[model samples]
Target: MSAEAYSKAYIARCHKTLKEWGAPLDGWFVFNVYDCLEEANELFTCELCGCTQVRIVHVMHNHHYFERISVGCICAGIMEGDILAAKERERLVKNRAKRRKNFLKKTWEETRYGVSLLWYRGKRLRIFRLGNGRFKVCYNNTSTECHKGKPITDFLTAVHAAFDLIDPVVEIWHA
Candidate 1:
């Protein structure tokens, strides 16, 4: 559907849902938003509009009714009375996903000592295999096990950890 049509439909559906719940249409606040690509095999449906195939979910709360609802980006904007903010948040999420994918696809040069090296954001990222058949990632002069001290079982995971380490703001959504 076109953006205009979708917005109109979302606004109607959201208004109906809120009215039925005895809630105000414009008082909803977006508390949290996240991409559910890694959590579920099937896409989520918007709670307000019943729209299917929603990947990025927005959690909204209404202070008056003390109700929370999960909806898609457009519906979220309608509920919150700020479509631009919703679109901007979605844009950031998409950009983060793209950056993470590109970070994994980057080629890491292997050193003679078996350390894999890649330069990111003017900093050196290194991944090396440990004697215990696990991996460790080094970035910004710091080296540690990935996944919050858990043993990294593969090179790909170590590389992902390096990306997360370098870009702390990007949430890791495993493909």
Candidate 2:
């Protein structure tokens, strides 16, 4: 269906269930969206249909009425302008999280804090602390003969920065 048709149907449903702020659908907007696996602690009920355990919750607001409501995807599908965009965003979030978790479990776990060579995947990571107190880092190499380009000082910060190249949100810890 066209956007206008969805908007019209959404407004009609709002008229029955949703409270309009200033001029009904004029100022209605979706603020946030979340795709739950099992279920989030917050048991959100659809303001439009009064359904429970909504898999996807669309946090919406009516600027005219100055009211906020959380509704399920079924209700949001009729009102939300682009459900595809929301789904795309959800996919990206999951992908990033999965990459980060795997990097931590595999790469981070395999990292061996050696006296001279910090090894991961049986290859020495191109990270070395120099005598001048600056740590040298090399980017994209297969062997020990790597470039000394990025310089870092702190150990934890350097570790975080190195893995951030793979996944920015990847966590670093001492233990």
Candidate 3:
């Protein structure tokens, strides 16, 4: 189906769902957006529009409603009444995924002591393996001991986390 037709159908479904749930149709805000690539092989059904295979999930909440809904980008746009902003948000998510892929593909130099290192944005990026089977990422002289509740279990995950840490600085540098 064409984009317009798909969007119209999704919007219609969204409206119907919202009305059924007694939720406001146009005042929902996206609270979070995430890529479900880890579950890519599994089918994801949008709660509002019933669309399947939605890779990027947008969690939306309405001020007047207590329950939140998870939907695809189109349904999110329809609920929020701003397709352009939803598209823009999805674009940034895609770019972040690309950057993470590129980060893993970068030629990281390995030290004789088994440390992985790379130079990014004039800062020395380093990944060190801890004795407890965890990983630590270092930028310049500062090192991150942990990444919130997520444990860095391997070199690749550490590198990805490093990208998450450094990409913000990269954006600031560009700005």
Candidate 4:
């Protein structure tokens, strides 16, 4: 089948699976989408369990009259066995949000004058100043020759490849 068709079918299956489990769908968004018919696939992992066990309890497909519109549901594993209590869940969520905010701020700083994005022989590389006051390579955008309608995946792989070029002493965090 075509890639767009495959994406649609796969999303449908994910919805089905979540429905079968009666999972709560919250804080979900479309990670990315093609112009009309494809989306990058995402799997929700338990932040507490270190990934591997499924904690999804349901799926809610809110329909919108737009092409390529889809939702990615992230199931909070709070309902799982020996899961964190209400207070603990609140603390975890707060901490995660704080980290996410900090990450975004750092990325913005790097994207601004704090970092330099240069193109060398058709490859993009980033030179940034770390919080610790050190100049380093933050990313290298080489080997991103493959391009389909999957802009999300292509963009991510490029960013990651660039991150891989970062200096070992630099600590790069993501949200």
Give stretches of model 3 more than 4 Å off: 6-10, 38-43, 168-175
lDDT (Cα, tens digit) per residue for candidate 2, span 37-77: 41344556677766666656676665566567677654554
Best by lDDT: 1
- Compute the lDDT for candidate 3: 0.76
Model 3 over residues 1-175: C-alpha lDDT tens digits?
1466455666687788789998898878888777777326454688986777787788888889988999888888888888787777777776777777777788889999878889976878989888999999988666675664588887777877788678752222112
TM-score of 4: 0.22
**lDDT of all predictions, in order shown?**
0.79, 0.51, 0.76, 0.34
TM-score of each: 0.79, 0.43, 0.83, 0.22
2 against 4, candidate with superior lDDT = 2
Instruction: List model 4 lDDT by residue over 26-94, tens digit each.
Output: 323222211111112334443222333222212222233122222211222122211233224334433
State the lDDT of candidate 1 residue by residue for 1-175, as single tens digits.
2567465665786798889988787878777777777435468898887888788888888778776899888888888888788877777876776788899899999999999999987889999889999898998777778575577999888987897788765332221
What's the CA error at residue 158 for candidate 2, in Å? Answer: 16
- Best by the TM-score measure: 3
